[model samples]
Target: MTEPRWLDTEEMAAWNAFVEASNLVARRVEQQLREQAGLSHPQYEILVRLAAEPDGEMRMTELAQRVVTSKSGLTYQVTQLEKAGLVRRRNCDTDDRGVIAGLTDAGREKLREAAPGHVELVRANLIDVLSRDQLRVIAAGLGAVTRALRERP
Candidate 1:
């Protein structure tokens, strides 16, 4: 086989740190949302997406795509949210087979209540940890990485 390509020492350290930090950040954010808002990350994302849509709603498949979740996963999450009175499901008038997910008043209230503490957790756990220059570099780098990943086959 041809010589294997591997990360150099510094690159390897950065990669490991990025992975660990991402996991820790996600866990902490999820905990905060679940405790304060009765919402998981996926649920919160769905609600947020619906609330931000033109009619405060989106087609279920579109929502799944926006949230980067599978159809079954989004359906499960939406069902749970529906149980909590945070969202409602409706059949699309334009297409009988298409479903629409809408944010309820309770969902908006939950998002409003959750946003403050969620932002605080983000600041405390990640944003506040970086210096101004570091923050800029991180933002740009992360955007590039996200774009690359999304573009990948």
Candidate 2:
């Protein structure tokens, strides 16, 4: 068996820094969303995806995919949002077996209100910290990684 190579000093430093920064960014964004909008990060993501859809509606399964959440998890979150008058669930008109989640007018208003804070948080924690050149480098590097990973066999 061949032994796996380990990261050298410089590589280790880069990897550690990237991991720490990624975690911090996520935490900061989550905190900002909760503090400014009374919404969790995952909940905000769900609302954002729903808002982007035509008629602000999508099937439960589609919502799960868009938000990268499990079906059950999405259902639970949707239920909570519904209770808040932010979203509602209904049977799909064309398919009896399918359920659809729809964003409410209140949801749109909440998103509109929350967007400024979210944008500022992102800019303050991540975007503003990067130069244009650094942004281009990061975008190209991460885009390549995602493209490679998303390619099918």
Candidate 1 ranges beyond 4 A from true positions: 1-3
lDDT string for model 1 (31-64, tens) is 9998998889999889889878777799999999
Q: What RMSD does each model have against the real structure?
A: 1.6, 2.0
| lDDT tens digits, residue span 40-144, model 2 | 888899899999988999999988977878999998899889999999999999999999999999999999999899999899888999999999998998889
The estimated TM-scores of all candidates read 0.91, 0.87
Q: What is the lDDT of candidate 2?
A: 0.91
Clashing pairs in 2: none
List the pairs of residues colliding in candidate 1.
Answer: none
Runs of candidate 2 with Cα error greater than 4 angstroms are none
